[model samples]
Target chain A: MSTTLTPKSSPIDSPDLRAWKSASGGGDTSQPPGLLSGAFLQETLAMTRRLFIQLQRRPSTLVAGVIQPLIWLFLFGALFQNVPQGLFGESSNYGQFLAAGIIVFTAFGGALNAGLPVMFDREFGFLNRFLVAPLASRYSIVVASAIFIAALSIVQTAAVITLSAFLGAGWPDPLGLALVVLILLTLVLGVTALSLGLTFALPGHIELIAVIFVTNLPLLFASTALVPLDFMPGWLQVVASLNPLTYAIEPIRYLYLHPDWSLGSVVLQSPWGSISLGVCLAVLIGFCAIALLAIQPLLRRRIA
Target chain B: MPPAVLIEKLKKSYGSVEAVKDVSLTIQPGEIFGLLGPNGAGKTTTIRCLCTLASPDSGNIEINGTSVVDDPKVARQSLGYIAQEVALDPVLTGRELLQLQADIYHIPRKVSRDRIPQMIDLLELTDWADKKTGTYSGGLKKRLDLALGLLHQPEVLVLDEPTVGLDIETRSAVWQFLRQLKAAGTTVLITSHYLEEVDALADRVAIIDNGVVIAAGTPNELKDRIGGDRITLRIREFTPDDEARSAQEMLARLPFVQEVIINSAQGNSLNLVVEPQSDALLSVQQSLKEAGLSTFGISQSRPSLDDVYLAATGRTLMDAELAAVGTRNLKKERKEAMKGT
Candidate 1:
C-alpha cells in the first residue's frame, strides 16, 4: 500500500539536506572505522563539554571543594597553634606547617571524588549513550572526568593557598608556587584515574561510594598531611612513607619552609631513608603512571 | 546495497539466563521493520546486540552489510539508535544535546549547522529546543531524542520502543514523522510491545517470544495466515457465566466457528473466531436467537495482530505480557544491558 508523497515534505528536496545525505553514504565494510580519523577528538571534546556543562549548571561541587579545605586549614591550624615552634620542625608556625597538608589533601579529595559523577552516569543509564555511539575510545569518558576534576582541583588549591597566607603562612616563591601546582596536578591525575577505575570495577555506585568512604580519610591521616613523620611511631612512619600522598605532601611542605628550594632539596625523612626533592617528584610521576596503567585493563574490559 | 539490517542466529546470555536464545530477521532498506514482543521476550536484548552495545555470545549482526560484531564502528556509523529510555543530559539544552550527538557521530560542522535546525523544524521543536532537557515534558524529551538519532542521517535508524510512554497526540506525531522518514528513503527499525504501534507503523514485523522469533512476516500476511474473522458478542454488560457458556456453545456449533473464548475481564464478552464470510455475524445472531439469547451488541472485523500471536503461541499478547511481568528480572536486565560483554 503506497501513499502519495508530497514534494514539500521530503527532506531530500532541500539542497543542504541532499548534501548531508551524500556526505553520509550508505555503507558496508569488513571492519569498523575508528582511529585513523578525527572522530576521536570530536567525541572526546563532546564528552568533556558535557561534564563541564554539568559543573556549570550545578556549581556545588566546585564550591564545596573549595570551602571544605578552608575549614580544614583554619580549624586544624588553630588546633595545633599552641604546639612548640620546633615541634613540627623547619616550619616557623602551625599555619605554615598545615598549609602544605591542606593543599595536597584538598586536591586529593577533589580528584578522589571524580568517579562519583561517572558512577551516577552509569547508574542513570547515561553512559549507555556513549557506549552505543561509535566512539573512537571509551576511555574518553574517563579522560573527560580527569580533565574536569583537574580544573576543579586547581581552583580549590588556589583557595586554600590564599587562606593559608592570610593565616600567617607565607607564600612560596614563584618557582615554589609553580612546583606546588605541578605536585597538585600530578596527585589529582593519579587519584582521579584510580577513582574512575573503581567506578568501572565496582558493581554500582553504592559500592564505589563505600570504597571511597573507606579510602578517603584513612589515607589522609596515614599520610604526612596532618602530622610530621617525626611525631609518629616507627611503624606509622613506614606507613606514612609508603602513602602516595606523603610523597606529594612533603615536597610542598618543603617548598613552604624554604623558598630557595631546588630539585635536590631534601623533602622527607622516611624510616628507610631520606627522600630528596628529585626523588619525591619521581615518585609522584611514577604513581600517576602506575595508577593510569593499572586502570587500562579495567577500561578495556568494559568499554573496548 | 545489502539489507539495511540482518541478524543470523543471534544468541546472548547473562550467566544462567538466555536473554536472547536465538533471533534473526532481515530488514530491507527504506521500510519500518518492527520487533514486537512482551517485556521479557528479549526485544531490547536483540536491539542491544544490533546496536553494538551488547555482544551476542554467538551469532552475527550486520547493519547495511557491516558486521556489528567484527566491525562495530562501521555498523555504528550506519545506525542511529534511540534507546527505549530517552537518556538525555538533563543539564544540556535540547540543541546542545543534539550538538553533542552530532560530535559523537562526527557529523561535520557545516552539515550539523543546517541539519540541526532542519530537524528542529521538522520535529516542531523550535520553541523548546533551547530549554534544558530537564525542563522538557516526556514528549519533548522523546522528540529531542529522535532529533539526536536523526542528526547524522544514518542509513538505518534504530529505535527501541519509540512510544512506550507517550501521550496519544505525540504518539501519532511520531507515527507521522516515521512515515515521512520512510518516504524520504530512510530505513527504520523499531521494537514495541504495543501491538497497535507495530500494526499501525511497521511495514514488516517479527514477533519474538521468550527470546526466539515465533512469527515473522508482514502484518497483513500474518493476520491472513490465521484465516478468520473476529466476532465479539455481548448478551449483556457483564453477562452471567451460564449465559456466556451457552453463547460459547451455540457459537461453537456453527460450521464456520474456529474458537470461542469468554473474556470475563472485558465485561464477560464472547470473543469468537470464524471463517471469513459475509453472513458470519447474521448466522451467529440467528443461532443465539434460536437459543433464546438476546444480543446486546455484536461486531465482526478482520483478525488483528494479537489474534495472529495467539494462533502461533496459544496465548494473546496481553496474557503473555501479564505472565512476563511475574518473571522479568528488571534489575538483572539493566545490569546486563550496561555490561558490554
Candidate 2:
C-alpha cells in the first residue's frame, strides 16, 4: 500500500514521438532478403568501420606497428653492421638481407596480435551486442578483424620497405616488389586467422595475451627471421626449415636478391632438399588454408 | 496474430549447473510481461535462449510464430533485446554507436537517417548524442542503450532489468516510455527482481525460483489467489516479549484472522493475514486495545506480489535474493554466457 503507482503520463510530448510509433509500423519485421550476401557485407563493413574509427582516434597502434619495426631495422641491423658482406648470403650489406626478414616478421607480429582486440571485446561484453543482433553471419565478426589487421600489415610492410631502402637495401624491381607484398599478405592472412581462432577458443583476454606472449618471440627466434637457417645447429635447422615463417622469409629474400627471379628459383637450401621460390609461396598458401580450415570448427562452436 | 512471444519447456544447462531447468511463458501483443526472479534464478539464461544468443538443451521458442531454432534470423528480426549490462563502445560517440547498431540491424540509410534523430530527441539525448559515450553518466548510457534497442522497432522488445541501477527520475522516465510503447502496440517482455517494479509495469508476470516457474498470472490475480489482506500492527514500537506473544495468541484466535506471525526483525511487530473486509484495520486496533496493548501503528492493505512470492517459495524475495548472491559463481556464469552454444 505504501508503493507509488507507475506514472501514466508522458514527460516529453513532442511531434518526434509520433516518428517512433510510425517507424515500427513502417517496415515489415521479417528477415531481410539476400541475408548471406548483402546483409553479410553490411554487417562486416559496419564492424570493420568501428575498428577503423578506433584506429583513427587512437593512432598509437598504427604508429607503433610501423615504428617498432623501424627500431628493429635500425638497432638490430646495426648490431650486424660489421659482419662480412657475403656472410649473410651474397648480400653486400647486412641491411639488404635483413630487410626481407624484418618486413615479414613485422607483418607476422602485427597479424599475431589480432586476437587481442576481439578478446577485449569479449571481456567487455561488447561482443554480446553482435551475438544478440541478427547478424547475417557471425563470421562477419571474425572477417572484420581480419580485414583490419590486413590493412595494418600492409601499411607496416610499406613503411619497413621504405626504411630499409633508406638504409642502403635497394628496392626490388616492380615485379619483385609485387611478389614481396604477396608474400606478406599470405603470411599475415594465415597468422591473423590463427590469432582470431585463439580469441574465440580462449577464456579471456589474460589467457589470450599469455598465449601471444609465449608464441610471439619463440616463433621469431625459431624461424629464419633474425638469422639464416645455416647459422643454427642441425637440430635447430630442422625446426627452422619446418617453420612457415621460414618459408615466407626465404621467398621474399630470394626476390630481394634476384629482381628477375622466377617462381622456380631456389630460395632455401634445407636438410630435406632444395626449396624453390614457387614452393615457398605454395607452402604459405597451404599454411593459410590449413589455418583457416582449422578454425572453422571453433568459429562454428563459438559464434555459430 | 500469433502470440508475440512463446517459450515452452525451455531447458538450458551449463556443465553441471542447470541454469534453466524448465521454463515457459507466453506474451500477448501490446502488453508488458515480466519474468520475476532473484539473481541466478535463470532469468538471463531464459532471455539469452529467446534471443538466440544461447541454444536451449530442449524446448521450443518462437517470436511471432516463427520457430526460433528453425529460423532464428527471422525470429531475431522480430525481437530487440536490452541487456542487463550496458555494453557501449566507450570510444565511439553516441551517434556513431547508434549508426553502427542501425547498420547491423539492416536499417536502410534513408530510414535510419530520420529515425536516429527521432530517437535522439525522443530519448532526450540530443545534447549528448555527439559526445563519446564514456563521458555520459549511468542514466545517460542507459538512455542511449534504450535508443539502440528501439532503433529497429521490432514487434517484441525484451528488456532485462532495465532499471536496475537507474535513479528515481530515470526509472520513472523509463516506466513512462514503456507505457507509451505499450500504448502504441509493442509487446514488451522484461525481467526484474524488484517486487514493486514488476507490480507497477507488468500486465502478467511469471515468478521463477530455482530454475522453475512457480507461479504465473496477472499481479492482481496472483495476489488475489492468496485470498487475504496483510495487516502490520506495532503494539508499542518496542513491545515487551510477553505482550507481543499475547497479542499474537489473541490475533491467532480471531475468526477473521487466518494467520499471525511475530516479526522480530521489525521490533516485534505482529503481522496478520486476514480475510478481506471493510473494517479489518479498525477491528485489529480494537482487538489490540481491548487486550490493554497500545497501538503504535496499524494498517491493512491488499496482498502484494511479495506475499504471492512468499506463498509459493516459502521465503521472502529479499531472503531468496540474499541466498542466491551467496551461492552464485558470477565469474563462471559470465564465461558460460559468452559461449554461443
Top candidate (TM-score): 2
Question: What does candidate 2's lDDT look like per residue over A1-304, in tens digits?
Answer: 1122224334345434555677544233454445367778878899999999999989999998889988999999999999976678877788888888888888888889888988887788787787667777777877787788878888987888899889988888899988887887788878988998898888777888899999888888899887888889999999999999999998888877787799999989999999999999999999998998898777655331
**TM-score of candidate 1 against the unseen true structure:** 0.92
Candidate 1 structure quality by residue, lDDT tens digits, A1-304 = 1111223453444554445555543222234445445667777788889888888999887688888989988899889899987888888888889888988887888788888888887787677777677777666776777778778878888888898888888788998888888888888889989998888877687888899899999999999888899999888898889999999999999988887788998888899888899999999999999998898877754331
- Each candidate's DockQ score against the native complex? 0.33, 0.40
Error of 1 at B108 (Å): 2.8
Interface RMSD of 2: 4.7
Tens digit per residue, CA lDDT, model 2, B148-193: 9888887789999999998787798788888778877789999999
Question: RMSDs, each prediction?
Answer: 3.8, 3.3
C-alpha TM-score for every candidate: 0.92, 0.94
Across B1-341, the per-residue lDDT of candidate 1 in tens digits comes to: 79999999999887678989989999999999999988889888888888877778998888877788877777777888898888778899988988888888777777778778877876667788888989888888888888888877888999999998887767877887787777678899999999999999999999999899999999999998878899999999789998899789878988999999999998889999889989999999999889899999999988998888888889989999888885878887666555555
Off by over 4 Å in 2: A1-18, A24-36, A302-304
Query: Number of clashes in model 2?
Result: 0
- The residue pairs found clashing in candidate 1 are A32-B74
